[model samples]
Target: MIIALTATTQLGGIAWLIGRPFRQSLLVSLASYAVLSISAIWVAPAFGRTPLSCVPEKGGAHAGIIFCVTNRHYVTPELKSALNDIVDDLNTSFPGIQLGVLDASFPFLNDFPMLPHLSHNDGRKADLAFFYKDSDGRPLPGGTLRSPIGYFAYETGRSACPATRFDLHWDLNWLQRVWSKHELDIDRTSKLIEAATANPRIRKVFLEPHLQKRLDVNHPKVRFQGCYAARHDDHIHLQL
Candidate 1:
């Protein structure tokens, strides 16, 4: 339980320990985790990190509540500001756009591993979901993602990366049929990349080569993450 909790949420294992000796372990542990997670919003800033809002804000929001519940929505102040700025920019042309923030670093530790994204150990990296339009050719309300957690719903595209047994390049072919029938909103996505690349604070944006061509994203800062890392066609990775 501790291992799984720690793997999912960095602070969950410690919360488990805090509730281990109690009579109602499940309730105690859950309550403990809630307290710890909420406390992180205040405590994390001391360590130079800020927690992204779990609720849908004016400009941005966690792609799903799962990210906040798992304690995976913390980022540096500069990054948070940059994301807000990008979303604010998007709203000017595309009104009421709520940028979906996917996996981000945990609060507190530097060089502490966030599984699947080892480089996200620091608070400088975050994943943003691609904007999607409903099958009817209309933008989904508030930029809703095709997948529940803003991941694994890949757009059809070709890649140069070869098959590897040890890497994180999971196709998850079986799950593709289960997602919502939403088409990638190419205009919004292209604009998002342009805005992100234009931002001087964002040093790099990792995306697949095919997507760059498909979306007409040609900025030097927008580069491929390579075969060793997970595919970025499903989401965008921005780092300082």
Candidate 2:
């Protein structure tokens, strides 16, 4: 039959192809298979299906524990890992500090007019608020919290620097209060700065001179965990 002859020809052609160089053919076949397998592993997710049962939700708290915020549409695995490390470090540094993400969501960044250039839009930045509770064990609203013990002011005003004038768009009173209340003395803040600087991922930490002065001379018991670049004065922005 024609089908039988066709099958014979196909088998014969394959046998000839394989016999030409057995070792090379086997290696080439294996390499092709590996490529296909890897492609399948990485490509399936893009098509809207995932192998894992639990996928991380975007721009929200996970497990009522750690919170996340990103400006980008998707979060890279590297960023997620780095954020996890930071959260772990914070928990170790301050026990029972309830973690939450600030985005275009609830009380923090959501609905608030953000500063133009100072806003955390690159998905690499975040603002963290200290968690506080009342005697009834209920979360105290951020507005109710006392300001940190420090005062913040620009050392030099630059007409060219829009971020230096960030007070025009953002309300940093709450953040200033938090830092003022919680900032540690200079010696302790220095230790925290040292630890953050030692990390390869952290580029820099900028503290307002006035804020630093307050921590150094004015009040005690306040400790700074870390800080970002100068542009982050309007908000506590974290880069990963």
- Candidate 2 lDDT score relative to the true structure: 0.33
Mind giving the per-residue lDDT tens digits that candidate 1 earns over 161-230?
Answer: 8876788887777899999888999998899988899888999999999899999888899998988888
In angstroms, give how far residue 153 of model 1 lies from its true place: 1.4
Candidate 2 lDDT, 99-119, residue by residue in tens: 333321111222222233244
User: Any runs in candidate 2 off by more than 4 Å, and if so which?
Assistant: 1-75, 104-115, 130-198, 215-234
Q: Which parts of model 1 have CA positions greater than 4 angstroms off?
A: 61-63
Model 1 backbone overlap count: 0
Q: Find the 10 residues in a row with the least total lDDT in model 1.
A: 55-64
> How well does candidate 1 match the true structure, expressed as C-alpha RMSD?
1.4
**Number of backbone collisions per candidate:** 0, 12
In model 1, the Cα lDDT at residue 78 comes to 94
RMSD of each: 1.4, 19.4
